[model samples]
Target: MPQQPNCFHAFQQDVSAIKLPARFTFPFYYQPHPLAEIAAEQLQQTLLTNNNWQHNFGLNADDDPDSAVGKMFGILVVQDQQGQLGYLSAFSGKVADTNALPGFVPPVFDMLSKDSFFKDDLAIITKVSNEYKQALQQPLYSQLQRQVSEQNQAFDKALAQFKGDASERKAQRKQQRAQAKQTLSEQDYLAFEQQLSQASVIDKLKLRDLKVLWQQRIQATQQSLDSVEAEIQSLAKTRRKLSNRLQKRLFSQYRFLNNLGERKDLNDIFAETPFKVPPAGAGECAAPKLLQYAFEQALAPICMAEFWWGRSPKSEIRRHKHYYPSCYSKCQPILGHMLEGLALDENPLLINPGKDKHLAIVYEDNDMVVVNKPSGLLSVPGKNIDDSVYSRIKRQYPQATGPLIVHRLDMSTSGLMVLALTSRANKALQRQFVERSVNKNYIAEVTGIVEADEGEITLPLTLDIDDRPRQKVCFDTGKPAHTIYKVMQRTATTTRLSMYPKTGRTHQLRVHCAHPQGLNMAIVGDEHYGTKADRLRLHAEYLQIKHPITQKVLSFKVAAEF
Candidate 1:
């Protein structure tokens, strides 16, 4: 391959005049770039004008035209050799004709290409998988399974026969004792019963021998079955090993170039993480593809953005024409290594934008204090954040001891929080929370109008470990979370609600609100589950609890400002 021209010179000339972004976006949480916004608007307009645009983009028409679930799109702003600014567009999976559209960039690797190594390796993988499947359906395999089943049944039948014989012998022994008792004195009858019991022991021992023999026969058949199963498992392992090897080789071939004139393959990019190498198609996401091409072509990266272009999937929450941050599981590791050597922007997410905001004290006492926590403030100190409600309380009361935080609210959710001033208060408040004595009401504005006036949502929730901080609805291994909600008012496209949570789990309300099985509508401005807004439209409205010290029932209310 010929060396590509360096497009960085034109970008460098304008670098001095450009005010770089405070940070490279975390890729998991961000607002779209200005250029991307323009591009998205243009794309939306194009779709409106062209009735056959879906066909052109190679998108399948949704079964329900009223549904908003569709596809994800991405755009990267770049500077050409002439210093002209233009954007590169891409889709999440694939667009029409394998991403061969004119304004859109192609994938890093063409796995769909007939001439590629992926095709050849996939053929071998398919052959092995088919062979394994065929082996399981062979006549010998079927015959062995049937033999095992028949042997098990035979053993069970024999065991039942032995048991029946033992019962009959016991009955005969009892009848002999009764007959002897009718004719003999009381002492003589007792002696006769003892002798009968001794005779019955001999019969029991014979039955035991029969049971052992039957058990041995069953064990022999089971061993045969085990051997067959082991053989089948070995074949499966072989197929899996071949497929894994092919994937590793494919990832190794996806090499990315950085502005430092250094090149590292996807295998090297993820070498340090838990995943030693990038997953399949790790570098094919829109952001990585555009950046890689820019570095190779020497085009300067100005800004980049990714958005969902169509309806959301049934399994996850997404909105039409809404911007979304890049995925962390696939893109983070790749972007972390790819953004090296350029005069890149600082990651704005790393900075605490709400540090200067003070915690508003709603109620205070010697034993405990209630504070109105602002949105964007952490309830407790995080790994990178030290300015939190707990930390602030500690600063206010230097003499206080024990865990101060009795509960927590989401960083994006503004609400009333009560902090304990002493260990006794902490224990008391914690007990109330555990016993479901504390009553809390949250006010929120959801994206869609709610049809019902009041209802309760019971959904099991568990963390999506792969995607940190994001929770998913999982019935099998999840904790139960409950929320009762009443519609306060309905707008044209939104519903304002008052929610009372019965159980607290991470992102409980957010997940419950957006879950298809629950309300099926996301809270407005829920960046993780819904669309981005100026802020999350959720606020703590009211709290009711017993005073830890006085044992007096106290209630506090803070109306939502949204």
Candidate 2:
């Protein structure tokens, strides 16, 4: 590539000695950068004052582990937004070394020595750089070729099986017809007819005349299945081979999940975090693990459907049209919300949450996922050294992913939550909630006396931030909300009430319970919404919804207590 005037750049790295497969020099990068600032004084002046940029490259071991001998030589240096040398990093380049290694020669060799080719011969270096840049796409091209080859193999395999199956069927039809006409005697034919009549289905007929056809078809089907399975296994092997290949060829590194239950290295680093714990007598088959597995399994298909086939708020795809991620600047933890309800590429076997895993699983189906969570746990990863439910779920099932957090429960308020796993279910379930077809109930302990045996708390609520009833009731222009309170039981100091929030609001129950006109009652143990115990004594007791698959009413009941 032709070098730009007054621009020069080189990788700033120095490694005294080298080892294999573990570490690299300069954290070894292969991208280009702007070297104008560090270039000649003229270039530096132009970069800082004029905001001009000149792209460049920094060679590593691929050139020469020590000197500029084997380097992929030449660069087009430039300045970047940060007033630093800038360009696309890790862009591929090449050298004219005849003894170049077959596999990748990592750019671990740093401490660049640029030739200031722009000064020496800008045009020559520019041509060389351009050529090298184009060569970088070779990997992508190779991948495409491999994919096409595999696809062709698969298609041919399938076609061959179909032809064999068809041939067998034709042979069977002819033989069977011939045998029916001439082979079977009258008595034998009568017996055969009787047996055929008794047969539950004509499609399952297995006669000697059709032996070649039936057996051949079976063999062909089995062969086709075996071929598909073999290909699948091979594909997996190829994927596994990639890391090793990349490491051997390019000295690359990445992460993999803890396959056998736990990662020892990770455990050593994070010894404080709890591992998957087994119940005292449950052994390896503990309830938590089983529950988690079953829940994950049920959600696998549904979760996948939402991402692959489900709609998105901005998606132009018809199937993904309804996938609206209720996330925006107004919604705090907005990114977290999107991650759970829109898109999350879970890989590395979903980092299982540790001690603070505060998720209350509400419902699961082939098409949806639901959870009843306490207030403190985040809906996704957030600022307070925490992550939301969406992050954890993605960590478990990396594929078939979507962030359809259909509904959200406040970090503090314990309540039922539902998420659609499939795009279709996402739309249906969302509609169900919007149409007020889903039933939910809560348990709360409120303060003060209650003369009325039962009454409705018609109050709207939003974030009050005020000292009294932080999530307070406002007769003003707050969101419309309502709660039905029935005195479940009462004490001289407190009233255990079953709260049914008719309208979902920020803090309807606590606000209503502590209405100033009423006993000025505050919910027992509600710190934010009221003053009571150490934590809010509220629970999502029961939930009801039509089963996604069966279309039957399914209710989840949890008796409440203070």
Instruction: Compute the lDDT for candidate 2.
Output: 0.43
Per-model C-alpha lDDT, please? Answer: 0.78, 0.43
Residue-level lDDT for 149 in candidate 2: 58
Count of backbone clashes, every candidate in sequence: 11, 52
The numbered model that scores best in lDDT is: 1
Residue range 83-128, candidate 1, lDDT tens digits: 5765566676565446445556667777777778988888988988
Cα-based lDDT at residue 169, candidate 1: 79
- Which ten contiguous residues of candidate 1 have the minimum total lDDT? 6-15
TM-score of 2: 0.35
TM-score for every candidate vs. truth? 0.79, 0.35
Specify the highest-TM-score model's number.
Answer: 1
lDDT of 2 by residue, 291-381 (tens): 1222222211011100011111110111111111111111112112112322223321134233364666666656776776655565655
